[model samples]
Target chain A: MVEELIIAGFGGQGVMVMGQILSYAGMHEGKNVSWIPSYGPEMRGGTANCSVVVSDEPIASPIVTEPTTAIVMNRPSLDRFEPMVQPGGLLIYNSSLIDRAPERTDIRVIAVPANELGEEVGSDKVANMVVLGAYIKARGTVSFETVGQCLAEVLPARRHDLIPLNLEALKRGAELVK
Target chain B: MAGRKLFKGNEAVAEAAIRAGCRFFFGYPITPQNEIPEYMSRRLPEVGGTFVQAESEVAAINMVYGAAGAGARVMTSSSSPGISLKQEGISYLAGAQLPCLIVNMVRGGPGLGGIAPAQSDYFQATKGGGHGDYRLIVYAPASVQEMVDLTLGAYDVAERYRIPVMILGDGVLGQMMEPVSFPEGSEPENAPQRPEPEWATRGARGGRAPRIVSSIYLKPEELYKHNLRLQEQFKRAEAAETRYEEVRTDDAEVLLVAYGTTSRVCRSAVEKLRTAGVRAGLFRPITVSPFPYKALGERARQVKAVLTVEMSLGQMVDDVRIAVAGAAPVDFLGTTGGVVPKAADIVERAAALARHGAADQATREGIS
Candidate 1:
């Protein structure tokens, strides 16, 4: 099955890095995956999003119009991408930042307090990872162990010590969904 | 299978260039492709290679010409407007028969367009962005993996024919990340050394004659002869290197022709069309210059109609028309100014074309 997702938030929210980590985990599972960022001026404080496609077969367009899943970490991202989610798919939002819930009734909506959970896990910088953890746990998209391995690869050697905090954030968020 | 690694397209291209033994890179910064030079700057030095952040695109191309003349594997990259500035140098490189790589991560344009993905440069890339009937063997990659693979392949093709080659991508492909793998031992340290050309401008030493690397053919006859030789090389490339992919073309009632990022959208549209019980296929040109016209023309005979899709306002469509050659009517759908065409819209339009006949050329313009 193909899981096409759009992960969007403010530029510093690690939206692009979240997409990369998930795509890297997909690769570990022998899945064909692609991560396409909405780069350019959006790299500033503007809303940044990236389309992540993980599939058993070769992925077609890296540009996702109606994604099977939408992860909105901020209000603007929800306002923009909420309508683009496919019916009977999934919508995961960070309730810590977004006050309103997704209005789509056909799709399953999961509200995780990613920022709060991230702070509880020791830092708010990994709020994106918290949301990612919930999505993977709620959807079983990839295993937590695989994500751990991917984090090792994604982080630089100097920053490897932060893996424990990131793992804690991931586990904390995953626990909420569980 | 080799271990999979995540790579942004621009970074992947840099890695591939290094693996292909490219030792010199000269380029100016531009949006949608700045990562290419940035990656080169960080990595080339580690490999004992040179990366020159030239003053301008014009200087960068001349630097490429210089490095290529010295028999070093070299490359330069730019966006659409910057590419135009290098046209004169490109023509000279072709005339001098210097093998080099030029990458254009195309952005929307006729002028200084937005920093978004576009295939608008199709005409400029395939029909000689430079003057004097020179063609850069253009390879349009549809994915990040292809971005790396075709980059390695482009060097071989350029060196084989001693002509400049291009790997045409857009902002989408340049900025995207994907799992890419290279063959074992494909890294620069493990790859075979690129053999130096005998005609290189090595300085006179020991009893050897000095070579002149020049494009100035003063006499009309000499210039004509040089052009003919280039044409012969082009003819050989057309015969031997035309690359394309036919997806579900057998028993297809309608065919969608596209390349680069547009082709990826077309593939999604084809899947949607099939689900709707519309028999559709996708024809993607991997090599835009040695266009798979003959192959597509033969396939056109079976399909009821052809719908050419592009990010540009119908540039490659003209070639599709020439290739179809009245065997099947050709239609077009596109957007300009950095708006990417949607797959759902492509499916709807392609299905309509399959039901009705191909629209006339004038009417086709209306569809865009």
Candidate 2:
């Protein structure tokens, strides 16, 4: 199976880090994965996005022209990526930021209060981790245990102190989807 | 620890170059490739190498020239416009027969174009952008692992031929992250060394004659002989270094020709075409300068049509036509200004070509 996902959010929302964590976890699970960020000027302060692919087969293209899932973190991201999800695919949006509901009826939609979940777990900065937890619950592309083990690999040693908080956020997200 | 780890393309290339014995890195900051210099700055010091951020692209390339002249494994990286500024220096290095690694992580445009990725530098890179009858062995790697492999291999090639080699990448390849394993350096640090070749510019040793390295020859005959020698070296590289990959082309009715990141998309397109009951394959040129023309033409002669897809306004198509040589009708589908084409569209075109057989541009457009 192949999972082509696009994760988008404002620059400080950890969009790129989320993708990297997933990619690292996917590799730990013995899968081929690739992650490419939107490295244009938008990366400074504006919206940033990344394309991630995890597959049982070798990943052909890292550019996601047709994504199976679009995980949006803000209103702009939701508005931009809501319609791009393929039919019977998934659209995971953060309801804490986006006001309007999704317009696409062809794909599955999940409105997650990622910010609330992150705050409930420990720190609101882990909102991206909250959404990632939900993503893992919905797709099951990589196991949460593997994600927990590989979080240290994706993050630096100094941030290792925050692994427990991030793990709680991932657990809360997975529980929210369940 | 190096068995497998996630790394950004730029950072991975930097570490790989370090492991490959690259002791000196000189470059100016440019968007999409800034991480290269930034990473070098931090890591080079750890390995006892030198990283210099030159004042300008010109100065950076000249610094590369100086380091290479001293028999050091040297490198310089830049984007499109920055690369253009370094053109004169690149030509000078080629003329002087210096060995160095030059990286062009191409961004869009003719001028200061967009910071988004594009392969528009195809002609500039393979066709000799700087000037003179000179050619640099240009490599186009599709993945970050290949980026590591080729970056390490490029230095050896540059030294072996006593010529410059270029790693032609773009924003996507430079900014992306993937799991990669380096050939060496699992211990996190190694002593970077600068090997002095016999022709190095070090002061005449042991009463030997002083070596002078210059690209200038006042006499026309001297320059002509020098040019002939360079041409002979290029021909030898063409025969020895041409590399490509053929994916399911034995019975392919239509062939998709592409390189670098674009080739990965075409690989997916090939699978889509086969699923749609069309016989399609891909020809990926790993070495763009010493392009595998003969191998491509052999495959092209068997196919009904050839579709050349690129991230430019059909630059590589010229070389594609030359290689096909009318064996099959060659068509091009290009998206310029950093717009990457979709695999679905590539599949549609290849399926149409496979169905209609030799669907020229007009005929393919007329199908609908």
Candidate 3:
């Protein structure tokens, strides 16, 4: 099956990193994947998004106009991306930042209080990890272990100490689904 | 020996240049191309190679000139605006007939336009940007792999003709990531020793006398002879340095002519056109300067029409017209200021041109 996802939020919200983690996990699963970023001045304080596609077959165009999954980290992100999710697909919204849930009934919506979860985890920056945790729980696109390992591989060397914290965030996020 | 490793195109170019025995790198940092200098800064010193972050693009190109004069395998790179600054230096290098590689990871421009991918420098690259009647061998690579391969070839060609060579690319090709492999044992400890320079400024040793390398000739007759000699070398390059690639042109009724990133888009367009039952194909000129005119001219005879697609407004189209020589009608489709034309749009134009080819008056009108 072909799955496309878009992770979008404000520039410094770790949204792009969330997309990279998902793409890295997809690669770890031996799937064909591509990640394209929106760069230039559009990335500064403005809304930023990355389009990632993972497929069992070769992907034709890396440009995703309509994605199968939408991960919205803020209200603006939800407002912009909710309409582009395919019907009956998945939408993971950050309930702490987004004031309202998506109005669409055709798609499955999972409202995760990621910022509160991050606060409980002692760092609000892990809010993206909370969203990613909920995504793995909902889609089972990859094993949580694979996502954790991929995270350790992709994080900067100076931040290597954060690996255990990030893994804890992922596990705490997975437990929220239970 | 083909194994894949993920890397950005700019890093790939630096790695490939190192593998191609390029030991001297002089450049200034510019956006979209900053990764190139960043990579070289860390890697060159590890291999005992030289990497200098010049004070400005002018200083960088002149430094390249100095190194090339010393007969070192040297290179310098910058974006469009910086390349504009380097034009005078490039012209001087051409006049001196120095062998060196220069790279332009082009960004949007007419002036300091923006830091976005653009192919607007087609004319500046192909038609000698600085003053003079000289040509620099220009290679445009469509992918990261070609970026590596063509850079290696750029050095070889530069040395063979003793002329400056350019690898012209856009920001997209520089920033995008792809799998690349390092050529095995391709690194040279140093550049091959050049034959004793008859005109190099080698300082006098043991009263063997000092040689001077200058483009300045006070007398018109002397300067005229110098230019004549340069022209002869250009002629030899024109005869030997033309490179291009063709796809499905044997029975094509319409040909899509493009280069670099536009060529990849056109390739996709050609595939779509063929799927839609139109006999359309692609002709990609690898070397933009010693343009593959003979091949293009021969292909023109068999095709009904040629469509030149570029990211610039009709710069490369003129060259296509010159190469086709009225054998087939040449049409243009272009975008500018960092806009890239979609494959569907090119396919639509290709299909339209093919369907109209049979109608004589309609085709003539379409050309006009």
lDDT of 3 by residue, A24-116 (tens): 777667776666566677755688888777777655444455789999988899999999999999998989988986899999998889889
Summarize candidate 1's per-residue lDDT along A136-161 as a digit string, tens digits.
99888888999999898887889899
Question: On residues B1-368, what C-alpha lDDT tens digit does candidate 1 reach at each position?
Answer: 25778888999999999888898999999999999999999999988899999999999999999999999999999999999999999999999999999999999998998999999999999998888868879999998888888888877899888889998999999998988888778877786765658888767677787788999999999999989999999999999999999899998989999999899999999999999999999999999998899999999998878999999888999999999999888889998888888999999898898777545433656873
When sorted by lDDT, best at the front, the candidate numbers are 1, 2, 3
Residues B1-368, candidate 2: write the lDDT tens digits.
Answer: 23788788889888888777787999999999989999999998887789999889999999999989988889999999999999999999999999999999998998989998899999999998988989999999999999998887787788888779999999999998888987655333654444578788978869998998889989999999999999888899898989999999999989999998899899999998888889899999999998899999999988889999999999999999999998888989888898887899998888888766744533656864
Q: What is every candidate's C-alpha DockQ against the true complex, given to 2 decimals?
A: 0.76, 0.71, 0.22
Please tell me how candidate 1 rates in CAPRI terms: medium
Q: Which stretches of candidate 1 lie over 4 Å from their true place?
A: B358-368
Task: List per-prediction Cα lDDT, in the order shown.
Answer: 0.90, 0.89, 0.83
What TM-score quantifies how close candidate 1 is to the native fold? 0.96
When 1 and 2 are scored with DockQ, the better candidate is: 1
**Candidate 1: pairs in clash:** none
**Tens digit of per-residue lDDT, candidate 3, span B96-215:** 888888899988889999887788998999899999878888999877778998987777788778889999998777875544555665655544554654555556777877665666
Give every collision pair in model 3. none
Q: Tell me the chain A TM-score of model 2.
A: 0.97
Selected candidate, larger lDDT, 1 vs 3:
1
DockQ (0 to 1) for model 1: 0.76
